[model samples]
Target: MKTKYQITTFLIALTLLFNSLQLKATNTIIEPDSDKDKLIIYILRNILTRSHYVVKDINDDFSEYVYNEFINGLDPNKRYFTQDDLKEFSKYKYKIDDQLLNEDISFYNLVYSRFQSKIKNAKSYYGGLLAQSFNFRKNENIDVDYEKMPFAKNENELIDYWRKQLKLSTLARIQSKTEKQNAALEKDPKTKVKSFKELEKESRLEVLKSMDELYYRIEELENDDWFSTFLNSVVGAFDPHSTYMPANIKERFDQDMSGKLEGIGARLVQKGVFTHVYELVSGGPAWKQGELEPEDIILEVAQGNEEPLDIVGMRLDDAIKFIKGKKGTEVRLTVKKKLDGSTKVISIIRDVVELEETFVKSSIVEKDGKKFGVIDLPKFYISFDDENYRDSAKDMEQEIERLKGEGVTGLIIDLRNNGGGSLKTAIEISGLFIDKGPIVQVKYRDQDPIIKEDVDPKVQWDGSVVLLVNEFSASASEIFAAAMQDYGRAVVMGGNQTYGKGTVQSVLPINQFTKFDEDLGAIKMTIQKFYRINGGTTQIEGVYSDIAMPNKYSYMKFGERDLEGALPWDKVKRANYNQTNSYQNFADVISNSKKRIAENKKFNLINEYAKWLKENQDDTVFSLNYKSFAEEKSNQEKEVEKFDTVFDYTSNLTFTSPTYELPSLKEDPVLADKRVAWHKSLSQDIYISEALNVLSELKMNNTYNAIVKH
Candidate 1:
């Protein structure tokens, strides 16, 4: 199933499956004698260029590894693709030669053209959606249930629906031109004489510039991964931590591993091809400037301190390259600020952000005379620094030591929002609690099995452990949780199920050595799949907890099986793990927790709030004239304001002085009221309160045998 998770791919259209590559500049050509030989030579050149990375030489090891990984996700019973096709792919295995790909523009154009036709079919819908989603991704008006869309079931309807999607998106762009002209008029007072029609025309032209956005998306992955990343990126951006990375994104995974990242400690996105800063990282260079912020339009990049170069139509990769640099370098950015509506140049210095700060601060949860240490592992931490290698093993070790000193009785490792990373580190970290043994097994297609075992014979904290995960916990997170659950060492608790990704990915660099060909570089194909020690697979069917909790996310449907081309569930030979005799009874502990939570007034109120939140998760469209829309929006806004005051206390603290007539967090105007309010809500974190109750239950149960188990 792990193999299946990484390998599920669906070709959108029959034409796309076998379409000929397109071209942009076809001014020159050679004598056409050996077209076939030329193509073969081109393939070889492309392969060798990228074939220089780890596990190069295209040896049997690389070939076999690629074969197993890719095949594990394949459907063998169906002969949709023949062995001959497999052989053809083998010849170009682990390679995409530069020479072969020098100017393969035709391929891109073909894909783009086919995709763009859909946009033309429905103009207004595409334009409208684009206008709304672009300006405010938070704008729920553009939301659509893909399963409910007409195109989801019938191919003919699907094409037309997408055409409308494009139209609405494009229309949205047209609305922005008015903003530009209004600005021009404000500045010069001479560029006037513009009516609403004229303004609309200007916006349409500017918006037309982004028509290629969706086209580029379809051409890039051909729907194979377009939908896969849709959920993770689209929704994940709502909260800084949530996101989805399908098994198909090896290149992105490799980028994260490379220690070089983009976005200037911020997030960039395209709601409708108009790229903008989604959010600024706290304490980031951009954040320090107090200039760049969420929803700021990135108009241009100026290298060094030079004149800004326009980048409106640039590729996302190119935009990213322009932003990232050595840790100490500086980059000046020209941004069209959304708030106060101004344009400004902000220069920022690059810096590394510690991932730990993004996570919850560690604290000891005491209940009924027992102590339980709780730590939220947001994502896998395996930084590529030389001395400060941020492996989960080392970090958890330090945390364990600290928690031990705090004199905690049990441990609750929260894996929520931890999408996954560094499988190697996950195994090593899991090994910390359990003695040396097989933690997880990975089986591939027609190949010998490879089992990843924690070599450490030493155990760190063998006390009662509880792992909290949600639908977002995936890959390495799943690996650790599954091993602990399979061994009956820890109780897995969270929402419906964890993200069912159980495959391991190895990033292969396509053009690592070339200084000239900057445009090249595709990350590796998936290399292998990971399985748990038990018989069941963690592929599409993620790990279900011993006890499920109510989550605010309800519109969120269950199971990856709902996804088209999603890899089906399968099983391989299971490995063995011995359950520790010292393991505490989790059922009893859970029962106590349930009783406590049911009686807790705060938790009950939170449950009611969570139920209210579920009904509002889906984005819905609204008209400017709808009274109900205004009322609903107004009511929600009021509720948020009230909750905002409540949220302030739980997550923040206020410091008021003798001169203060009102409470405030800081003297600064921007940080005064809201910050003060946020501090107030810090005490009202209902979910955290529930977790505290569980910790208390574990404490009373394990106090006698509280010391770390060895």
Candidate 2:
């Protein structure tokens, strides 16, 4: 009787009814104050599950993923949560998906409350540990890779772990101070060097101060920060790239995208208990005021006619908020100059500051009787609000034209450290090199792939080209490199692979779909995956360099594939496009370059340095004994001295801008100085020199082929 179709249908209905009841029972009611966040959660779920490229169900499997990822992200070092805490949390590991579907945040509340308690306890542990003077003679070592260790069994174990970490940090600081004081005394006989005991006391005081500041900052975390982390964990469960941006974080992103800021215009970093000036914007309020300088430690910040607040022990972001005021508002800063420990109060009015250094710049490098152009594009930046904004493609085209007028024989597009932007711009930039064809193919869920092409037949430069990239070059940068490599338009050179980001993200503002009075931030979701015209996706495998050079980061494992929960690599049908036969003997050319690099002294040095770096990084266990730590550091320094000659190599090349840029360079001293520095570095770069040689080889090879044809 149960085998009948009617019996099967009844069983299915019973299971569904049970799940429905469970969903209702698990539903949580958010507080009235958090109604807006609850609404945002609802909207985000719909967007991610419905509009995202990959649709997934909020079930037990998904709940387990969110729970594990959230906990791991919070306690990356396993220093906070104990074994008992994790055991308790494991109960809701598979139940979180139900809670999320029902808009219940009881799990988040419970975890976050426990997290706060742990942090408070951690603060006490650090305080007690630092209150005791560390023994430098102790023969002990600490594990830097704390992730490999298990969670503490109890409070006693956690306290012991904290003590070891604190001891390690204290030893490092003491070693650094000892070396600095010894060098100072050696340089000047009149300068008095403190005794070892005195130096130890100073190091302890500095470490304690830093720990206090760090804990103070942690204690200041509001509900918004914790909520953002929780929401991000949910979004991140989908993919590494997709995430929710809270209102405050989104505001900073908007400013960075616009390349404009209203502030004192000085970059600051927390050094011990003080916020030290890293750099001053060339044309910003701080530089114009002419009082603030790099390495100056800011002590206090004051608003107009208001009492100054001590910023020495304050968090960097909080200190910055105090220093940054609206346009035309006067903010005062109490600073201490590093060169001479003299305190000075500088007052300045904030104004709109636009960063000019983040733009297209080109320098003409004359090498081996041939002139070549190098265009360094820091980022593929464009303004969505401003239609007439000068984007990477438009500016790059102009830089090429200028370089062409300078009679350069070849071009190099240096996209090193360029974290990509603007997919449209990447396609347009790729088109500038080729005559006209499909640039990249974008595939959305359950839809035919969309082919983006350049209908314009005009080729920007029809000559030997080389594109330079590094591990950090990603997204749009990979797109351009892949297109060029596919079409043989440029010789891709640099690290082994480009950053393998081959996904497209679209920002969805939460308030757009609803009439919410409160500001609900945006969520950037991956909507499509992109592929090269040749059909291969650059997801995890990234575009491989045609000529791989030995790099300092050769040992570092930073790639898309290295990221957790990253999408896998796949291929689609290749777009119909013509492969340019520009370089007929490309393989022979690469082989020859490899041979040359093998014999080059600088390349060998680089290879050795990379190996040494890997060994050093893999060594996670560091000695806490002052003598052993000092000896290890000293050996590292000596090894570094061997590679000093790596930068000593120089090319007999002259660098200059085109005639059109000279007039502007003359007027802007800052711009001229930057150009000079760029040229100086280029001259010292062995990689660029080799790239120039490759261009020369290509030109010679072309000439030989032409003679044979004749």
TM-score winner: 2
lDDT, residue 231, candidate 1: 27
Output the lDDT of residue 116, model 2: 89
Model 2 deviation from native, Cα RMSD in Å: 9.8
lDDT digits (tens) for residues 1-710 of candidate 1: 11122213321221221121111111223233424223322322333332211123434443344333333222111112234434544553433222224423232233234334533543444455445323222333322333232213343444344444444433443434444676888898888657755544554444444544433433444333323222222222122122233332334444442232363676676432346875454435565555676667786677777645555545455677788776778888877664322346789887665443443334454466666676656556665545475566677877787777767777878787566766767888888877778888766434555778988777787666778887767888888999888866777877768878755533323222122222222323334456778766787888987766655432354345444334457777777666654445567777876676567555455455555555554433432222343455557667656444322214222222112213432445544543343333323544455555555555323532343332
List lDDT for all candidates, in order: 0.51, 0.76
Model 1 lDDT on a 0 to 1 scale: 0.51
In candidate 1, residue 464 scores what lDDT? Answer: 68
The C-alpha local distance difference test score for the whole of candidate 2 amounts to 0.76
Cα shift from native, residue 628, model 1 (Å): 7.7
Tens-place lDDT digits, model 2, residues 338-436: 433435678999976656756788888777777888888867777655889888889989989888888998898888867777887888898887778
Question: What is candidate 1's CA lDDT for residue 611?
Answer: 57
